[model samples]
Target: MLKFFRSIRQRLFKQKKFKNYILYAIGEILLVMIGILLALQVNNWNEHRKSKGTLKSTLKTISSDLKRDTIRAGYLIEIIELNQENSKAVIDRKVTIENFTTYPRTRSLVTIYQPFDIQTKGYDILKRISEQQENEKDSLFADLTQFYSLFIPNIQKSNERLEKVVIGNLEEFQEFPWFVDWSQGNTTEEMIAYFAISEDYRKKVAAYNVLAYGNHLQLIKGYKENAKHVLERIEKRLEED
Candidate 1:
């Protein structure tokens, strides 16, 4: 094409048709400009397609991560509820202190400090994508950031506080005979009598268990809701594609 245009320009110039040659020159310049513009438009389209593909992939990963979180949260919530019920039974005398060592239900009350495992790798990838594409300030991105950075961390902190309280109370009460074996200290009857005598310690255990139970419930609710919202948004975005 360049050779064809060059041959025309040479012919026009050799024929001393300066007026036609100038007009042809301007026409050639316009054609070249049009070709450059078309190339640029195609490049922009390619880039946009690539970016959209990346976003879709990122959203898929985030959805999977959120799904895992919801499942784990559900399991933890069940455990928390069971722990609460067992502790309450012990406190209310439904499950007597005499059964604390031998009974399975009563045994769970003493085992505290279970922590929730939150997955953050997906969120971290999203965060990095947001940083790299600073111009793309979408609402979904903002919600994702808040969920991972603020809401999730807040739930984790609450769990940490609950664990601390449980640990502190357990440390104070570990020397009690009920926590130890019959061979090491008092007999089962003697341990039951000790627990029966210490109403305050029993109440503390019950209170901490209840606190943890409530916190876990609230965290699970928030997490599930957030996960649902994020998944819906991702699906919607993918649909738009």
Candidate 2:
């Protein structure tokens, strides 16, 4: 094509058709510019498609992470229920050493507290993508930002509160008149009597269950619902193109 254009210019120059030559040159330049523009447009189209596919894949992975989180949240709520029931039995003087096995929820009193470990790797990847697309102001990204911003700290706070209460109760065992001979992991009769009847011990159990763990349970449930909503939004985005 360059050879052809050069031959045409030479012919025009030989014929002294300066005006025609200039017109032909301008047309050639215009054609080249058009070609460059078309090429750029096609390249941009391809890049946009690739970026879209990447976003879809990222969202899908995040949805999977959210699903896992929801299931975990549900499980944590169940654990909270069990622990709370156990605590209520103790608070109400319904459990004792002889009937400890009957209260199946008497599994965790001061040791095992629910600390939520939410998955964030997928969201981290999404955040990087969002940063790259700062100018775009994607509404989906905005929703994600809001969802994560609202929940992450709440989840962290819930876990921290639960830990504080449970661990604080464990530390008090040394001061308790019942746990003086706390050598074995086994619960002693004295400990059972104290937990069942002691007002101080009942208050401690109530604080552990009613204050922090209860709030933790509610937050987990809320997080699960929000996660489900985000997953639904992701599905809609994925379905479009």
Candidate 3:
């Protein structure tokens, strides 16, 4: 193609037609500019396609992570509810050394509490998307932040209270003869000792009062709100159908 154009230019030059030669030169320059512009446009289109694909993948990953976080939030809420129920029993004078199985029940609740904590991995991903300027001002990111912002702090607070319950005051409660003397398979003696249930019993009840119960309930409520907001955002984003 270059050689063909060059030959035509050479023949026109030899004709001594200066005006026609200048017009031909201008036409060649215009064609070359058009070709460059077309090539650049193609390159830009490809780049945009790649960027869109990357953004879609990132959004999908974020959505999946949010769903997983939702499931975990539900589990935590359930455990918190159980803990609250146990605490209420103690508060109502319904818990007793006679039904000493409550101690093991409380221990099991603590075990569930152990695995639970306020995590921001899902939120961290959303922040990363925002930091990268990948999805700024998008409703998905905005709603995600809103949901997590509500619940995470309360969860942290509840976890702290749960820790205090298990480690700070529980040992003192277990030191009583009614509770400690149960290991010798002496339920009858333990029940007999609890007949009067004096000031010592009152003190233990006080410790249980402040430890992890109300806070856990607060966390459960917060988690439900968070999950609800998250689900709403996800439904809206995916509804772009």
Candidate 4:
């Protein structure tokens, strides 16, 4: 192609058609510039396509992370409910010392008071997203921020309260040794002796209520909101595709 154009130019130049030759040369230069522009546009399109794929993968990761958080929230809710039930039983004196004459189901109340462990998966994804340069305009980011701001601090606070409730005055109670001592099968007996009184057991149960239960509920609510937003974003991206 280049040789063919050069041959035409040589013929024109030999005929001394300088004006037409210059016009042809200018047109040739224009064509080359246009080709370069088109090549650059295609390159840009490929880059944009790659970036979109990366963004979609990130969104999928975030979706999975949110689901994990939802599961954690549900688990925490379960623990809270169980704690509430046992605390009420111990506090109301529903389980009597006579109940201990039999195998007291109430004795395992202290053992059931498990705390929620902070889930870091969602937090890690969020941090990664923040560090990246892409997807700055996505509304999902706003939803994520709102969700984390709502629950993260509260969850942290609840964890602190759980530590306090489980540890504070734990050594002062005579049953603490038995509770901590898992070596003996008589652990249930120790629990029964300690919680037979309504006052102390109820207070610890109340602490669970004050700290974990409400926070778990709040976290679940936030997770749902975030999940909903994420689903919407996914749908929108699919539609755009």
Q: TM-score winner among the candidates? A: 2
What C-alpha lDDT does candidate 4 achieve relative to the native structure?
A: 0.64
- Number of the top lDDT candidate: 2
Evaluate all candidate structures by whole-model CA lDDT and list the values in order: 0.73, 0.78, 0.60, 0.64
What is the alpha-carbon lDDT of model 1 when measured against the actual structure?
0.73
In model 3, what are the clashing residue pairs, if there are any? none
How well does candidate 2 match the true structure in TM-score terms? 0.87
RMSD of model 1, in Å?
Answer: 3.5
TM-score for predicted model 1 compared with the true structure = 0.80
Ranking by lDDT: 2, 1, 4, 3
Instruction: Name the TM-score of candidate 4.
Output: 0.71
- Higher TM-score: candidate 1 or 2? 2
Sliding window of 10 residues with minimal summed lDDT for model 4 = 103-112
Q: What does candidate 4's lDDT look like per residue over 91-210, in tens digits?
A: 666666666544344454443435445455655666675687555576666666666666667767666666666565454454465655532546565556666665766676566555
Per-residue lDDT for 1-241 in model 3, tens only? 9999898899889998888889999999999999999999999999878766655555566566656666776876676566657655544656566664644443233323443455565567667656766565576667667666776676677677667666644465367655554435345554443422344544454455454445565565566566666666666655662
Worst-scoring 10-residue span by lDDT in model 1: 102-111
- Residue runs of model 2 more than 4 Å from their true location after superposition: 96-101, 104-107, 134-138, 174-184
